[model samples]
Target: MGRRAALFILFAATALAVMAALSRPGVPQDRALAPGPRGTGPIIVAVLGTSLTKRASWPDRFAGGLSECLGREVQVTRVARANANSRWGLAEAERVAASRPDLVLIEFALADADLTDGVWPGESRSNHRAIIEAIRERRPDVRIVLMTTNPVGGLHRLKRAFLGPYYRVYRDLADELGAGLLDAWPRWPGTASIPDGVHPAPEAEAQIVVSPLLTLVAPGFGAVCG
Candidate 1:
């Protein structure tokens, strides 16, 4: 790519992040992580997240999608808890880094987790950055991918509005470090199959979460609709 193209992409990505922060939401905040040299060797994909990553969740589905795209064996390890909070992530930071992942996806949905407390994300942002620093310490070459999640429903549009800013933490981090991102919130393709609206249903996972992740890691690599 030419210098002009690279700078143009950066500007576009930053603009997209600003737009998502200002308007839509799901996909990571920044588009700064333009595709780079892909890993040709076997890969270890680690996910540090909350409920969205647990009990055979997005991490699991993305593993399958990435495998087909890479045309090689891939291992996915999840460090997730059900509350969709970042507390457990802080506790297990070492374990996450020990996994030595070539790629890492991180999200906590902190703002939407406890709307009763309001949309304060100061702690949420710092803790996640600490986790990223920890992982990066061990593997400097690792590609960290920030992914905003599905739109919430129980609270309806309100929950999404509250949660959108929190997702920006990941986007800003990605931009600062020049990492990868999925930006699932605004980009998610379908309806909330769940009654609560916060968690995406299984079917929604395949289309919104899994397929897009596949497309990100490996373009043209089709994801199976689970």
Candidate 2:
């Protein structure tokens, strides 16, 4: 074949390969597969966390995004307290189970790492396990998701001295308990939007928090996009 024709063919083949790679079911592409049904009735999602969840309203956004992604109704219940940590979450586990959620999203690493809170890494791990066990005690079949939320900045970073260790507790426990995890600390491009150095601003929440959680859980629920 002529050199120009051969080069053209090779370029065409590479472009097709790239296109095929981009169209994979798991990847976000221009066209997405239709969402399949997730049983009957709206999905019950219980979110247990600290102020990061209570204030930003990502759980609500996640509910809507998930509904669209899965083509089903998604109802989110947030059981959160400002400055509460995993230790506090243990107290609310029974309440979370009482809601009879099909899925539970737990985000407490941020608060648990607080020096003033005094949770530390060991206690955080224990609290996380207890919370998971408490929820599963009543609802064995429920899907549990653990989240290591946003990294702190400026002064807040100083307060959370053991932040990395606390976040590791969630990451480790997620594997041990066979639950899903959204390790969102690294997902933040920067802390510029976190005015408080902890909670994500409204505009940044959807992209950084909600989208990644949806992407993580969507496959398990039998769908794509979040």
Candidate 3:
């Protein structure tokens, strides 16, 4: 073959290979898959945490998103209290367990500092461990996913002092509990994504929180584009 012709053929082969790679199964498609059935009975999803989870309106948004994605009926119940610690979260989880939720989204690490009343680090860790144990005991079959709260926007001090540790503890706990982790820390790209710095704006509904949780709950469900 001529030099130019040989080069052209090689380029064409490379392009074909690239296209094949892009077309592989499991590769996320441009179009989102149609949602499944909404559960007949209550598909309870309890979101336990501090004010951020309650005030951010994540539970409502998550229920809507999950329902749309799974095509199943989902009733998300929020058992959250402002500034409550892991201890409080476990108590709420007990109440939620009685309801027999299909899934639980745990968001208690942010309020761990609230329990730090002159206690040693070891004591705090023990308390957290006890809480996780209780949750597992109550809901052995229930799927539990840990949600690490995002850093407070423009508040470097609070982020460093409170959110940083909170994120670490949740990360560790998720691993220990063999639970899924939705670390929202890196998900918030910029201030524009969060209207009030702490709470995500309605526009960020699809990306920051919903998308991650969807992936964890239903990995092979379908594509989710903003």
10 residues in a row with least lDDT, candidate 1: 217-226
Show model 2 residue runs off by greater than 4 Å: 1-37
User: How many clashing residue pairs appear in each of the predictions shown?
Assistant: 10, 0, 9
Clashes of 2: 0
lDDT on C-alpha atoms for all candidate structures: 0.67, 0.76, 0.60
Q: Select the stronger candidate by TM-score from 1 and 3.
A: 1
Please give, for residues 1-226, the per-residue lDDT of candidate 1 as tens digits: 9999999999999966674465455334434334556446677888887776774466766777677666667898888877656656767878988888877888776433465643357877777777778888888877777777766654455444456667666677767766667777776654547656666776666566676566565532222222
> Candidate 1 overall Cα lDDT vs. reference?
0.67
Order candidates by TM-score, high to low: 2, 1, 3
Q: Once superposed on the true structure, which residue ranges of model 1 sit more than 4 Å away at CA?
A: 1-41, 110-113, 116-119, 156-161, 189-191, 219-226
* Model 1's TM-score against the true structure: 0.73
lDDT of 2 by residue, 1-226 (tens): 9999999999999966664443222311111112334566689999898887788768888899989877789998999999787778998899999999988988888787778865767888888899989999999878888887776788776687457666667667876778887777766677898887887897687677777778777766676665
> Estimated TM-score per prediction?
0.73, 0.80, 0.67
Considering lDDT, where higher is better, how would the candidates rank from best to worst? Answer: 2, 1, 3
Candidate 1 C-alpha error for residue 106, in Å: 0.9
| Model with the higher TM-score, candidate 2 or 3 | 2
